[model samples]
Target: MEQRWDGSVVLEAGRLLFRGRLGTTHAHAHAAVQVVVVRSGTVELADRYGGRLAVSAAVIPSRATHSLHAEDAQGTVAYYDSDSHVGRALRSRFPTAPGDRVTDWTAAAVQSACPPDAPGGGRAAAAPHPAVGRAIDRVRSRLHGPVTLEEVATALHLSPSRLGHLFAEELGLPFPAYVRWVRIRRAIELVRSGATLTQAACGAGFYDSSHLTRVVHEMFGMAPSQLLRDVQWEPGPQRIRPSGPGLAGAP
Candidate 1:
């Protein structure tokens, strides 16, 4: 039987945090680096290569395909932009081999690396290129309509090819992937504001509910209903929080 995810979610620029019971998730990959800290029961992390590790805590590197199997297990899951301060810190502290994607750690170690202050305040991360920044703002503003890289680039006075290159170089994800993320985030925002899934999908510029459902499941490993159903949501900060202490100084 497929389990339901019940938890609280906090979204900040470049970071998303969830605390609650984890549902079984299908194998999926996204651009953010993911960290899972299991508090009770077990959550299994499986890779595409048939390797499986039952972990209390683990970090899955960016864009690495994997799945989670958790039943009646309570834990925390955090997604971080690979280029953000804390994301860089975690990757730095727990360096992975060239091809390795998932690193399992003891619960204590995971907690220590991700201290309460780690997600709050510290030094500001380097800003993205000016064009990339503008392009992002443009995407957010146009989420209610069709947004295309060519149109965004034209408005920003850059060729589509140049803009696409910058997105990959600065954000570590392609332009299309970033657009999908923005759309999904916008849909979640609409749902949090009391819109039904169908309404949220249209409001977020998805073709319809099914389009939104497919995107959510592909990127997050759960249907929009399962992911957004009856969960507490903390107001997200207007901007990304500065990096804090912990993994930054880790060896």
Candidate 2:
């Protein structure tokens, strides 16, 4: 019952696992690439650019913003570290494994840069909102220091407004909001994984623990301390816990 974002839940090797029900309209963009395997259920994924596709289980590349809406009321879902050794091994066996597999291998290449367990689930793995993948890479690489949205835009060769539009249209959040969400999410993972509050905050690009706390409370509606109190870790297969009422936004 590991419930923390940074936690892991282990399953019997080769055993099929089921993730719980997921939201119908939730979208998020992460720093790492993600491979989603739906053991038993129907899930619909929609990209930021109004592209919609149905996939039982699929590998989604990094920095591509997408949402998941479960077609079956009662179904099972599993997620793996897209950048993990297990993930790579699984991808190598893609289409050959089972279920529907959709992905751009060119995007998969970016995931090989680090070992699977490098931390923060190898950087969120949920793909970015289209071409903003490069911008996200810059954000991850420079998260430790102050990096402006303008700088990210420049690196991606787009105007700030265009970048902002991409984020809003694709990921369902504006650029600054998305950046804050990512930073806070990373900070939460770090803290739950054993970093001191201050350390986690700073490491995840927050000005201070208070800053992290504010964002966490705003997004998750719970204080970080309370959130980490019952945390546990599990490995093997992805499990989607029941969503709380306030747990809005992307899946």
Candidate 3:
């Protein structure tokens, strides 16, 4: 079933469940344990630690920071909330299993978990090529520092020219252009989260606010101040509170 931002479904045995094709980069964490069984096609799961795991189906824990890359030109996934009874049953059946086998029982289980009207669809995009994955990892890790094409190429043991070519071929963007996009995207997040333009720009590894403004305008067609004008600031949970012997009536 397709879940809305605040909606979730509890799956039962003999019910078939599925999710539509989705491609997104998460800016915040989500809280839902999911067990995904791929009836057909492949999926690549990437974590914050720069590790990429390719699996046809896998169990994902709630609040784990990760992104999904669909391998099937059109990938279909059968999934359910991991806390549900159906989820537990499927987990028991799989039992930490690892292979590419698509058993009849697994197929039946998938169909049973999904709604009758759900379509068995596939992902519309390809997984990141190996070179693209490496490049992306390097860029993401260095988003808070100066990142140059030569530096990334050196880290990946590829020539600058060759790396540029590979990026264009695999990701459809020049290496430098991709890096700029990453920087701008990161800056947008920081700015939206109550950081000053200068603070956000510097945090995102841009030379200064002016550089950030230029890139933001090019990518988003808006100035940082204008884009962030309506941003609402909310206080985060207090990590520590004043206490101890001198805490009371000291002033």
- The candidate maximizing TM-score is 1
Which segments of model 1 are wrong by more than 4 Å? 1-3, 82-84, 88-100, 103-112, 115-126, 231-251
- The local lDDT score (0 to 100) that residue 43 gets in candidate 3 is 52
lDDT by residue (1-251, candidate 3, tens digit) is 21111111112222222333322223212222234444345555565566666555554432344555544322333333222334334334433322123242333344344332243221112214676577677887999998988998899898999888877544434577667756765665565455788998999999999998776554433455544553343344211111111000000
Instruction: Determine which window of 10 residues in candidate 3 has minimal summed lDDT.
Output: 242-251
Off by over 4 Å in 3: 1-127, 233-251
In terms of TM-score, which candidate is stronger, 2 or 3? 2
Give the candidate number with the greatest lDDT: 1
lDDT of each: 0.66, 0.48, 0.46
lDDT string, candidate 2, 91-182, tens digits: 55333322122344323434334332233432233344555667666776777777788889887888988887875544433567656755
Error of 3 at 69 (Å): 33
Which lDDT value does model 2 have at 107? Answer: 36
Please rank every candidate by TM-score, starting with the best.
1, 2, 3
Q: After the best TM-score superposition of candidate 2, give how far the Cα of residue 237 lies from its true spot, in angstroms.
A: 10
Instruction: Give each model a TM-score.
Output: 0.79, 0.46, 0.43
